[model samples]
Target: MAEKKAYPLRIGADVLEAMQRWADDDLRSLNAQIEYVLRAQLRQAGRLRPPVPTPAVEEKE
Candidate 1:
């Protein structure tokens, strides 16, 4: 996992309330929900690339 840095954000009350509701519905923390939405939008806008899949390793019996 990558290290997480905290930053102060100034947001409107209505926006924060909406995010809280969405986070509740998605069963994620508010910070997680915010990051999720940002990442999704970035992918849609071609600002971020989709994650690559990891290859499965075969186990010996």
Candidate 2:
């Protein structure tokens, strides 16, 4: 499993409520909802960065 970085976030009450409502409607957890929203915004703005460290296969000795 990949390690997750934790950070503190500050959101206004109205925005928080809206996010909670969106999460409920989408049947997704709050964390996933936030990630989805951010990714979509980045993609729309063409600011999404490419993934780093191309995947590679390992061979056994």
* Per-prediction TM-score to the true structure, in the order listed: 0.86, 0.71
Runs of candidate 2 with Cα error greater than 4 angstroms are: 1-3, 50-61
Model 1 Cα lDDT, one tens digit per residue, 1-61: 4589999999999999999999999999999999999989999999997788788999999
Q: Would you list the C-alpha lDDT of every candidate in the order shown?
A: 0.94, 0.89
- Clash number by candidate, in order: 0, 0
Clashing pairs in 1: none
Lowest lDDT 10-residue stretch of candidate 2: 48-57
Error of 1 at 60 (Å): 1.5
Expressed as tens digits, the lDDT of each residue in 1-61 for candidate 2 is 2587898899999998999999999999988899889989998899987557768889999
Q: Model 1 Cα RMSD, Å? A: 1.2
Q: Best candidate, lDDT-wise?
A: 1
Runs off by more than 4 Å, candidate 1? none
